[model samples]
Target: MIGTWVSILPPLIAIVMVLATKRVLLSLGSGILTAALLVASFAPVETVKHLWSALTVSFWADGELNTYNIFIMVFVLFLGIITAFVSLSGGSRAFADWAVRHIKTRRGAKLLTVFLGLLIFVDDYFNSLAVGQVSRPITDKHRISRAKLAYFIDSTSAPICVVSPISSWGAFLIGQLALILGTTTAVNYSPLSAFLMMAPMNFYVIATLAMVFFFAWTNIDFFTMKKHEEIAQKTGQLFDPEKEIPGQLKEDFPEHNYGRVLDLVAPILTLVAVTLGMMVWTGYRATQSLNIWAIFENTDVPLSLVTGGLIGTLLAAILYIAQMGRNETASYRLVGKALSTGVKAMMPAILILLLAWSLTYLIDILETGPFLSTVVEKSNIPVNFLPVIMFILAGLMAFSTGTSWGSFGILLPIAGTIMINAAPELLLPALSAVLAGAVFGDHCSPISDTTILSSTGAGSNHIDHVATQLPYALIAAAIASFGYIILGLTGSVWVGLIGVILSIVVLFTIWTVKSRRQIELTT
Candidate 1:
């Protein structure tokens, strides 16, 4: 059961239950318990121990503190506090008022988010949270749904990081590629060169990014997303007030009349600057090298996050304090309230994150990833369909395990080995398909950390984010699958690229026409 088909059941059950009940903690708990039972061979005492270990390991592991998990959790709490402080300082209201006066339209607001998402590609976690902080006020001002904002954040963060050579994702993947290609004497390209070459071949990233811009510029949405957008536009409600919004402040702070846009911009800028600087400094310290790529590859990302978050949080608090004498609304008494509200706002996200991590830990113990990769390894599929098959398998593996990095670790070597032996010419395309599929699946998986953070950043209900984003992800995935098929069959990246572009054009054209007709009918 540990490394066989039975290992797949827990994730499937979790996914199905979450979708059916929309109770994230309960679903994740069920999955965790199921995996623990299986790992403990259905012995009650052993299952309890496994569960305890899983929960404890999130903070303490291997005779030491799990700094990575602790730092990330601390970052989340810091972000929440920053949001509360920003609002208490009247930065949120002031920024939204400024944006409404300048941006003037929903399209401008949405496109602002798109551009911000693209610009912040250093790390997906940072991108997700930062973009939401900047864009949420603007988008909410224009009545864009929280789900839609989450979609924008989710689409831009991972896809951009995966492609950008300077990003944390790029550094990690390059390291993985070095190991994968090191085994082969036939491949002549360096890991960095291979990564750059494979970037254009990642059709899912291309499709997803294109869809993001299309939706941003045209304001077209479908399925659950369309419903969310309509509700927002008609009612001026960003999300259902009744639902659990992970990062939404439970207590509303009074806005200061003298609040300025600088109040909002300064703290966010401080966060981004500090985080990027720390990433380089930490990486340089670790490697003792001046090389930019080497620095990124060895950077302590979680440490950087907490460092930046602490600075940002302090700056936000200072800003509120600075307003004490100038603004009648500002008071020392409200400082404690803001801190408490901020922590309360982030509690839901923290709990969900912990549960998701626990379940992922149990899933790893189950060897679920290897089981899925094993199935792909032993398949006797034709060479022409290998790219598509790898794409699907990688997507499934990532979707089940809720981690694209995990999928990359397990699948890249397998795909490389398979293609190196079967057809060396198709190696890059096959590997690109795996990368694309992992992002696609991660983009859709409810339990994915990036996905959860996107929801948190946008202040949306987690299930709403997952539900609204799924249809769009599936559409992009379908286009990517077609592109992979063409690449595999023709053995040409250019032809495959054309196929992806054409598919997007065709789908967008049809969707546009149908949307116009529906609008005409409504009018």
Candidate 2:
């Protein structure tokens, strides 16, 4: 029972199924089943039966799709409903139309699209749909590919949220930190400070945004993209501009008949304000109750995000109905219809989540993390170079797993423990490395939820987007790796900070030069 063959089979099966069929659910499900079968093969019949029973109970009842899993699904549905209502009331469209009227140039359109992504970091799901839906029309107007729009949306999703301390991601990170800090102490190591510290070190995110800005300002793209832009310019149809909306978008779909932009902008702003205010209030309470904080900190984030999103959506729905001049009671029907449409739009995400969770559970049951960690330790890597090795390992694990949170959950605690033990000074940098690597892998993995949502949002071929994005991610990763080495040796934040800045400047310059040449040729 070496089980060596078992180790490799599941992922191989998953990859083949995904590449061959392009069916995400099938691939993920196949991966889970394969792992289970492998585990069973190694155990005696009686042992196998017991293992199966335990694994099933753990996976279904306490695994990824258990309590928190259900919450995220419900939240996504709620978000969908809110978005649907906003669109139905011409709020979303109104905002888009207004942006179009104000920002006329193609360059400005791309810049504004990126800006929208950064602004909507409250939640990745919201960032995905809101930015995608709002910017699609503008990107179409500028002849930007849906692929590019998806790139912007995907880059902004977790990257922005992870760095923003007040976002849903921020709340979650803070809660996790609180637990690790033993919750009762009023420690200075706030999740907010951690985010701020790492923001400068988040080279991938910073570089990607710089690329977007450079391209928008100069119109430069690498080899094939430039050609695609040229062809789009000549033919006027490189990317399909088809607008798919829940029945709600009909009135504002074409944009010409949409209401004033403020109708949309006001509600969205209100949603942001209310959500942030609630989070602040919740955070304050968590800080005040030492006992309750210790017990509730672990659960606060998902709870808060769901509640905040629901409240924001409720407010949006009210405003939508108010715009229709209907009595509050009469407006229930509109809200109901919008809710139905919204939940329907999120059906795909809901299904994917279940399958993804199942796959994650299977991996955990197989003890993938410990197995992988053992392999890395055996590689005889130097203690000093371990941070760099961990960075690469984190990326590989995340890409294979297709879940950054899973990657972080498995690797962070281990890496943190090891770093603190090895070079106490390197604790923060090592933590940042784990975070960066996880994000990098998630950024490019085709099976990643964020990646899938990005493709769905941009309407790009999933594989193509993954393939195109890999280069950018790898480049940033290479630079980040070098930064990790410098930090490990010098033990100074400035080394990594300077490295990140240099990487962004160099990448942005390349983007600028290529874009300017393309624009001149197009003109």
Candidate 3:
């Protein structure tokens, strides 16, 4: 199948189908069925049966589902509950009030958003909702466009999660890496060690977090965002539909009468503590050693997350119950209601996560990874440009799929295989390129869950969020591409740092040019 060119058609068709139909489910289904048919060597009846089984059972079965995914899903569910309880307890509102007092200027507000987003590096969905909930009032007070606020929330979530060592995104990546490299000694570093090294090389993530400041501090806008900002400053019309109509949550927060800042802080602290403690326990269990480095390297991240997530939820519930102190039944009911609310809020995200995993499982059956590796290896492209190729292609796939996680699940394996076999030294840069591209693509994609959550959290018009964020994302992506090229040519991490600096310069230059053009138009 390495030389079998037909193998490439399924993913390509899936992407194209998405562009044409605007139906991810249909496109994914078509792609999966196509792969199954191919695997069946064009037996129509067998293909149908195979597709049915895959569609029905791939995400729940032993071979495909596995413990890691199960734990990840469970952790996600509990995390949703935690978010809801925090919001219901008035903890989020309380935190926002506290934070707003310190944020005297628009720059401070935006930076605070960045900081909060970074702090919630547990999961992407939680990051978007929590950060958006906390920062919106402050940004609105400073006349920042909802679009801009959405950009801040959206940019920080996935980008931060992907790089964090103890995050769900990190756990997912490790699980995938473990599958490929296995317990066998194929590489010198553990997956986590390699991930941390590649983290800095993630040009897009680095550029994105920095770009937020550039926009906030400079007060510059290079696209429609400028018009929205102007509208907000002039008319106080933040969610201006004339510019672009975008979808967002109807209600920002539930009508609640009680809550405190500590309600939020207590649960978050407990969560972090439990997570860390479990990591140590898992590490000790795995290696029977107290070596901190060894523990980190061998820690079972998914297990720790699930174990910690459940305890954290229960711990938060207890705090809420005690604080809400009333009749026993009333207190119990209050906590119970909040937990359910949180679970309900997370439903859409959970469904999307499941679908993304299912799609990946089906693609796995087609051996898309091996097929991609072969294609890259045999192509006429030079090794120096491989990172560039990977970034663009992976970005496109993510954009089409509306999911960075799914794209990573599909492309990382391919990228890893290609890098390991063709140029082992380039592994870190190559993996980073794939990761950066996936994040960039997900950032730009209208259908992405984080994008939707950002809009919802910021209370922005969904289309407006996408319209305004695209220019900023594209700016970061363009610079990231050049960074990859430089990394490829020089084969040096220092060269990658140079790329980041160049990206900032390019961004500032774009802002300057756009400002001049707007000034000229006014005159």
Candidate 4:
């Protein structure tokens, strides 16, 4: 029990440090170091020696240099490159221009922002930037806070990936499930099936989207936004100087003109069209080498993401050059500089990723999994409460690891085995529990790439974004946990119905309370 306390201290201490100091990277690094110290502190000298050996062994044993990891990295890099070109060539700007032309009202602008976020489900990385860049001008135009825009982008990024087929997330889920299933028989987890099955269970995600539409339509948030609105109304200034971008800056980069906006739009659309075609091509070509049963044998995640991103960037660049007459076209030197900038923007995300991976290793060294298993088995909770328990367990593990995929990798196998032995009928609910919890933890984690992107997208402080997002995520998770409990009692569809109803009620209640309070304060 004492050893278990030692195992858990690192992440807890780290969270406190982050909340207090607001330094994201420092907090994560301290957490990793603490986990290492815990392993060295509690275990015997011989055990410490063995642990050192195990660290080296595990590092070498890790298939990171394998084709799979390499492909995923390449995809991430390529996407960065593509996004750079989109930004440089004004593809993102062009899209923004077109959006502004069509979406005239503030309400229309916010709704379109959410819609565009859904549309960019091919990759979370793409979604963060594309949604942020294209919508920032319009959001600013309407006096919407960057914080709110970030919330929309952050919430939508993982939520969409977790739910949408034909994404890196979809591929990763298939690969992870296959890893656990062990037969390579194209187990029932196709991208589509996984999407449909998990979508209902994804209560936080579903609720968040519904909340976004409601808030966007109603202009309601309890704390910060409400206060800002009152201040604006009282002062006769619609735009808060603290929140708005300066007029001089806006003058330098004026809102969308048609030609400039088209310059951005054509290339991005081309990239998307080509990426889809490439995915189809890859799937088709893969069959030539492997049987249908082995559809995912050696399938590459990083490679797919990078390849799509790179191709999109290239097409975007070419279109930009064509749009710029020869004299004004991107020179080789300028193109190189732009590519460098693109890659540089990804540096923080890449560093966070490596650190996040190391953090997962730290949690393993801390023995989180066994500790969780012990606590759950000993708690004497009701049998029907198991799924809810699993959800909490999965969330803790994910928050500590800072990687939903890693959490899923470990817990899905355990949950799968448990379902087989303990309650076969509860299999889907258990699996759904794992997925929902993992995404929820990832969504809130300071070290998460999605979290990092949200800050970058909004140009808000990372801590500011984290602070604003937590309340919403936790509220949704509470509803989701109850939903899983209901599923445990009934079946999947019934649970979904209950979840949908509960989520709506919850969202509406929160908004109503917040809105009424604002009205009361104003009056």
Candidate 4 on 1-523: residue-level lDDT in tens?
Answer: 2238567776777777788987666777777666766666646674456345433432344534445434544544555565566555655565556666777877897887889888888667657755665677677556666667777788888788877656767666766655555533324555346546766776667676777778778766755545544443455343334432211021111122323665556555655566555555565576665432233333343355556666667776676566446435445565676667656655555555555555556677677766765676667676667788788888887776566777777788777776656676666567778877887887777766667666565544566666677777786788777777777777665756576676688769876887788789989
lDDT of 3 by residue, 298-370 (tens): 7787787788778878877776667545423335566667666666655554554555455555555665554
- Candidate 2 Cα deviation (angstroms), residue 136: 3.9
- Any idea what lDDT model 4 has? 0.64
lDDT of 1 at 137: 98
Prediction RMSDs, each to the true structure = 0.8, 5.4, 5.6, 5.7
Against the true structure, candidate 1 has what lDDT?
A: 0.94
Tell me how far the alpha carbon of residue 481 in candidate 2 is from the true structure, in angstroms, after superposition.
Answer: 2.0
Task: Summarize candidate 1's per-residue lDDT along 186-289 as a digit string, tens digits.
Answer: 78989999999999999999999999999999968888999999999999988999899999998978855877788788999999999999999999999999
TM-score result, candidate 1: 0.99
> What 10-residue stretch in candidate 1 is worst by lDDT?
252-261
Q: Candidate 2: deviation at residue 8, Å? A: 5.2
Expressed as tens digits, the lDDT of each residue in 1-523 for candidate 2 is 1224356556567767876776766787777667766667645674456345533542357345454555556666666666676666666566656666887888888888788888877667657755665676567666777666677788778788777765656656556554444432333466556557766665556666666666667655554455556666677664533422221222222222434555555555665566556555665676664443233332344455567567767776767666555422225666677777777776765666566556655666666655666677567666667667777887877777677877777776776666655665665566667777888888867667777667655545555566556666777788788877876677777886687678778767776676567668989
> What would the TM-scores of all predictions be?
0.99, 0.78, 0.73, 0.78
Instruction: Write down the lDDT of every candidate, Cα atoms only.
Output: 0.94, 0.64, 0.72, 0.64
Say which prediction, candidate 1 or candidate 2, comes out ahead on lDDT. 1
Candidate 3: segments with Cα more than 4 A from true spot? 1-48, 55-59, 63-65, 119-150, 157-202, 222-257, 323-339, 393-435, 438-471, 487-496, 516-523
Model 3 alpha-carbon miss at residue 369, Å: 3.2
